[model samples]
Target: MYTCAACNEHYCRRGELEKTPSNCPCNETEEVEKFKELYLQEENYKLSYNSALVEAEGYCKKTRLEEIMDFANKCDFKKLGIAFCVGLNQEAKKLAQILKENGFEVCSIICKNGSIPKEFLNIKEHQKVRPGNFEAICNPIGQAMFLNNEKTDLNIILGLCVGHDSLFIKYSEAPVTVFAVKDRVLAHNPLGALYLSDSYYKDKLHKK
Candidate 1:
């Protein structure tokens, strides 16, 4: 029922609570109060507080990379981990190098770390991207376990596939953040489709 995205006025952002749409999420004051209290928990407090500082200080002024560094610095994280897709190995290397240069211990794991075949998941040969060829399933759980073993202070996901990223986040012991998402159709920039939803991408997206 909370349809904030459909609301054009966004009165909540302007603090005009009385002008907010009936189905606006902000109308759920009890949920808001509950989350407010939850945010004060030790782990949640650290993340929420430091993230807010990063947002305020870096708003429109700093790139996402810079803000990540600033947030890590503010959180006093000494080590970082990257769980990256095999397709984005080059990008992961560059990101790891940057983090290392910034004086943090960096550990990077590839999605195909375990060399697990798709057959292990009972995937049929016809279902394989290239039939009759070995296709390793993306091992997000292994990536998370590897990073967990490294005792990383935080984990960054570079380009994990949709469900793979979910598993990674679920298994990660440290906090996780996404550096980028996998979107082969848009050079990993999925937002491009949304930006053109009413134009070039409307039919493609709405196709049966």
Candidate 2:
């Protein structure tokens, strides 16, 4: 019902409440107050304030990695955690090196930490990506629990699969941020599909 994505005017950003569409979220004054109160909480306030500063100071001037470092420094989070997919192990190593160079303690956990078989989840062999072969399930819950045990100040998710990443976030005790999403088709840049949605991918993107 909230059709803000389809709105053209974007009166909310411009502070033109009178010109806002009927379905605009700005119309919900009560909801806004509730969110405002949430932002006032201790951890929430620090995160919201520092995130706003990171956005303003780095807008169009910093890569996501740089912004993440800047935000971490602002929040005074020293120990960083990485819950990464096995497919992106190399990328995770490079990121860990960079974070260490910047003087932060790094705690890294791989998706296949436990080496538990896919059958542990009752997944049939045919359902496996490669049938008749052993497949270790991606252990998002284990990653989160390990990071939690370390008391990581912040957790970075790298290239975890869709539902797997959700499970990681759900189990993580620290503040979570996504470093990259899995999209092997587009070199992990999923936005390329959206950019082509009205052109090369029009038919593929739209449901029949």
Candidate 3:
């Protein structure tokens, strides 16, 4: 049995334990530590992932633009795709521009690309952020398909809605990186929930 000490959730090492427990026993600090040790240190991808991290850190510390260019030259990536929410179009455009300036072939797609209505999927009209206005459904599948058609080597996500991002990752053929998550309150910083856990997010705790 594999037990998640932070959650007190036991896994039989079977096909189950797909997602983390909804009700975790450990506080945010403890959870973060366990996650770092397990995912960063022991994870299979740690070797390649940590090598990139170390290289990026060293590139930032001991390199000029020329050295950085030389470092990026080693990456096999060619075409880059950016899929972003319409709300964050400006930010996405800026990011695309930066990437283009850095010599990457960039392809940017807005969330409302196909203009497919949310009602088509049987989603309640009233539940939309802009009711009565023509609202486009978040087209994660389309975004991924479009990027796949473009044959992008790498895809970057900026401000994709929580569940939609998951679908995008599932469908995408290229490797994906998240530049910004869809947390509007914390200004793209999800850790703010952990930072002020004792105060603003005290309600999150099951027992106090």
Reference-based TM-score of each model: 0.95, 0.97, 0.70
Instruction: State residue 9's C-alpha deviation in candidate 1, in Å.
Output: 1.4
- Give a tens-digit lDDT track for model 3, residues 1-208: 3236554435423434344454533334577677677765443354456447647777657543333333334455668889999989889888878778888888988878899998998878788887788888999889999999999877888899999999999999987777778989889889898887888788984356
Superposed by TM-score, candidate 2 places the C-alpha of residue 55 at a distance from the truth, in angstroms, of 0.7
* Local distance difference test scores for all models: 0.94, 0.96, 0.74
Q: What is residue 192's positional error in candidate 1, in angstroms? A: 0.9
For model 1, the stretches where C-alpha displacement exceeds 4 angstroms are none
Which residue ranges in model 3 land beyond 4 Å of their true spot? Answer: 1-56, 59-72, 204-208
Question: Cα miss at 44, model 1 (Å)?
Answer: 1.0
Clashing pairs in 2: none
State the lDDT at 42 in candidate 3. 41
Question: Pairing residues by index, what is the TM-score of model 3?
Answer: 0.70
RMSD (Å) of each candidate, 1 decimal: 1.4, 1.0, 9.1
Q: Rank the candidates by lDDT, best first.
A: 2, 1, 3
lDDT of 2 by residue, 1-208 (tens): 8987788889989999998877889999999999999999999999999999999999999999999999999999999999998999899999999999999999999999999999998999899999999999999999999999999999999999999999999999999999999999999999999999998999999886
Q: Which residue pairs clash within candidate 1?
A: none
TM-score of 1: 0.95
